[model samples]
Target: MRRVLGLLVVVFVAIVCAGRDLYEVLGISRDASSPEIKKAFRKLSLKLHPDKNPGDDEAAKKFAEVASAYEVLSDTEKRKKYDMYGEDGLKEGGGGGHDPFDIFSQFFGGGRQQRQQEPSRGNDVVVPLRVSLADLYNGKNIPVSMRRKVVCQHCHGKGAAHADDIQTCHECGGHGVKIETRRVGPGFIQQFQTTCNKCGGKGKIITSTCPVCGGHKTNFGDVEFDVDVEKGMQDGQEVEFEHYADEFADRSAGHVRFRITTTPHELFSRDGDDLWMDMNISLKEALVGFKKNFVHMDGRIVEVNRNEITEPSQVITLKDEGMPKYQYASEKGKNYFTSRLLILCIGQLNIKINVQFPDTLSAEQKQGFRELFAM
Candidate 1:
């Protein structure tokens, strides 16, 4: 019976692809490699899919043609025959009776023999991580401890004590859904399908559940790892650990992301790559000029000097003295090692001057100032 159906399909495909060259349909050379053929098919199928090109008849037809071409060309034996003798050779039992959407699903999400559906993904876990502003200036490694669900080791995530103890659901015929027809009116009938309660949509029943996980297929466990806080990483930047979230039976684990939060510094504030700070100066120093040692975030000393009178509300700009410029690993290239030199990669530091005036002037000081200024 299946052979008859296969023959009918072959005949239909031969009719549709009668004079069309399979290689031309896929826009690839006759000697294209297997990976090339697959790549071409994936690209064309995505663009010409029926869902993407809704209400477009020409695209739908081309989509079918592309799928047909890939179906025949992807198979080693069928491809050999089609290459040698053309589409007619496939009708002689070269094995080209597969569905096109099945191929798409196999590449996109589900493996062969499964319905076309998006791959299941678990939810991501985001945690807040606080660090000092100095940590962002100088890269730091922060150790983090997390509690996540891991697959049961004893049952290997099967949810059953033994493989033989698992059986297909009898209620839905292992499809996990039941269809029923009901009378809607005197002469009308309605049909609808619902998830089978017996199997909870799992399509399998475990007679002997795993003692450790109790058929849940996972257990909570503690895990620890170091989160690298790269230099100049912006606030709220996430450090991601892939596939480290809670585990499920058949779904892929999501990422564990740590959102970096930099703590406020007492002496410095940042804007993009620049650092702003307030510098307090005494009235005498502002008038006569003075040199002061300014401590940087990494304990480096920066000399703040003025040879002339320093006015209040003055701004002093220091080049390449702020935060380190953040560079991605890929962007580092050959200059990564040299970037540690502040002159090579850094930002500006702006210091705003605030001069404190003396509350009371002595009579001798006022007289001296009056005589010096010839008032």
Candidate 2:
């Protein structure tokens, strides 16, 4: 009876060991394809890699298990046998085993195919660009800095350490979509289609995750670009950089938009294409005459002189002294100066009649003097 008990115990142990699912070791379902199995293995391997988690025996064991799972699933013939006959099929060497990377090359086409495939575009970015009045007057090139995501250099945007790490999706069976039926009411049902849950609608999976990017496959870094400000551009204008956005998955490169803002100037006030300024003159200068020199916008000295007596509130117009015409074939503008005159009385004197000079003036002259003084 004891001998019989020992045999039964052996049988039970075998059954328990054989029943352990290999899919769990690779963190995947039994229906996972060759590519999906590889992708999952690579992702787990990187996290539990001996090089990354040194001195951790558990992690090392996990990494080994992941590698082993990839080795079996990546080979088509071996994978087929494993799917049909379990692990025992490979013990007799009938399975035509191949390297995991070779299987990836065959399934994905080739190296050239991977490179020629279109990558997802990035997002468009925008920023406010401030410019000086002078810059606005004569366009300029402005440099800008920004941060954005770029494809990972280590994995080349594959999101895996190697090609062998990719796997076909089990949930959708590589179709990338799933159909479902839901009961709307008694004896009635509605059908709808949705992306596969297992593959997240991609119809594929990463067996081995990229060690450098950890499956993110992108890095954040600084980007510098130059935007051209066109001449004669008005305030609040925008300059666009075509296809210069931050690179990412799911879309093509977008544009970088720059909004232009003109800074205020102390010396000049802009009115359309004309510039205005204030000039002051003394009252004496206004009554008599005055000549003055002022600086133009281009730093040239211009002299303005007035010889005629300028009356109070009289305006002096300077032709062509305004701002340059904007895209107009005209160079005419009026600069007006309003004069304010202040008259001053120095003194007043009262003198005796000069016509009777020396007390010997003629009677006619005296009469004339009396008459002039009477009024």
Candidate 3:
């Protein structure tokens, strides 16, 4: 009975020591593909890099553990050994003499030593900006307003109420990584690796949460900006705001992009760089000739006059009346006016005349008189 109890206690200790779930370690479901496992590892590496979080021993340990798990699972031979013998198989050189980190480094191109840090640029954000057609034609600077995420002023972007609240991570032993294993099929086990949970893979912990942001690194608000639209600028053209994106804790930011949108105009339709306006004329005016004038968008007067007969569907060209040329040249454009004509005809009229024909009028004259009188 004493020997049996000791055996049971040893088994319990073994189970307790091997507590991590491989599936959960890699943050993937049981059915995750090999490629998916690799992608998850890369993402976690970037997040929990030792350089990103300094002096975090737990994060470093977690990182190494995640790397080890990936090394075994990513290989067919080692995977088989791990499947049969578990961690013992890997430890006893059943994996054919392979260094897990070496394999991981080869697959992910190896880790880099900390180098000179550079100021990070912000991200770029895009918003649709609407403008009138007239504004596009004449060119204008549109003032735009939007709300964006900015750094918190109270905590100086540390996201904590005070510095003392921050603490080192305990789970990964400051390595910021963890390892896990799963049974794939009969006699086959797959291993997965992931960031350490206790430290959120950061290999560090915040003993005291920030009172302002509650340990969340970010906050939100409004930002106003201007978009300069050039004359004859086409719709959907992008207006850029350099380095105006969301603020980061490390003071890195991105840019803001604005897409220009034009509102539909009642009087005109735009085609490329040209502007089109339709004018209607009566048939009488088209035939007898007439003068027509209309107001332009810029409050300029445009007139069309013709003394000679104008045919229907006749187009008259007006120089320098179209939209201003964009980018290529500053030359003015031309305007085309169309004309329609209608003609009217009256019936012949009859007249009464009393005339005395010569006394010697011929028989032809008498016939003519009889015909005329009958009509």
Candidate 4:
């Protein structure tokens, strides 16, 4: 009996050593990255899937091997064990018992039928964000803080203390719904289906609920995100954070959008990419000539001078002094285009002159003004 046991151990070691390399199975190198491994697995799985090649035992076996290889390599700890100790190391680390079909289904969005049964997205959340004109003019990253529903950290959204604590509901048989018959009239019956009361339409029962969320599988947590206000962004433009809304168990999180709303500025108003401001000037400055300076939105001092007479309500155009033109995704990051094309797209600043007149003129001042205007 001892000899036979020794021989069995030797045989097992030989089989494990002779087994094909997992990397070679997926057609990737030993140094392949996670994304590379995933890409290779996706390609091979698509071609060797049982649905694609039915009744081919060879393809089916290869598909299973590929799934197993990906399952190990995708996990950081499992992959480290496998790399050091091979199959025996994996066994020692409690690895390599996952269902291959489950991994495959999850990677490919649960096949076609399971995808249809998956829960829809939750409700989207939109919040209004107020920004100053200076922030929009110079581009800013504003940090926003809000409370949102996130998956419970304790149970990982399982709603149970342990995996074994969850079991299929007996009343609905895991269908999440039950059929009932009601008497409508004499010798007549109406049948209808309704959510299972035992499972609360979840099709599963938790023996012990999660302590953090109390079986709700989610909790409201404070989250902070940055809202990028690009230069020349229009009012009411939405900045979307995908999958950042309230999360619920078994459902995808909806998107969160922050709609940009510019606060009223005391000096400047914007239209498209252009900026307009009223410049108050004394009557002498408008009639004779003057040089004055005004502060721009970005704290730059803009100088305006008129050697000739300036009139009230006259608009002066300052080229390339307003907001910077927004660089779209398609046109961004090109050095030559930014230097040549975008440089010419800056918005103009229109300065509307408003002349202040004196309430009354003395007789000597009126005579001097009349004599000066007579010239």
Q: Alpha carbon lDDT of residue 154, candidate 3?
A: 64
Local error of candidate 1 at residue 169 (angstroms): 1.7
Q: Per-residue CA lDDT of candidate 3, range 184-265, in tens?
A: 9999988888899788887777776566666666677676665667666778776656456787777667667788789998
**How does residue 291 of candidate 1 score in lDDT?**
92
**RMSD in Å for candidate 1, one decimal?**
17.0
| TM-score of each model, in listed order | 0.63, 0.47, 0.49, 0.63
Q: How many residue pairs clash in each candidate?
A: 0, 18, 31, 0
Per-candidate RMSD, Å: 17.0, 31.7, 29.4, 16.8
For model 4 the local lDDT of residue 205 reads 88
- Which tens-of-lDDT digit does each residue in 249-296 have in candidate 1? 788787788998999999999998899999999988999998988789
Candidate 2 lDDT by residue in tens digits, 1-375: 323432443343334324345677777887774435645764575455444564665664454445455666656677778778887775586432333223322322332233344455455567788887666555567878788777788887889999788888988888899989999999999999999988999999888989888989787777766666644455665555545566664566666778878787665556565555544566556556778776654567877687766554444555555443332111121111111101111111111111111536689988976997699
TM-score leaderboard ranking: 1, 4, 3, 2
Candidate 2 at 249: error in angstroms?
2.7
Model 2: weakest 10-residue lDDT segment is 337-346
Q: Per-model C-alpha lDDT, please?
A: 0.78, 0.58, 0.59, 0.76
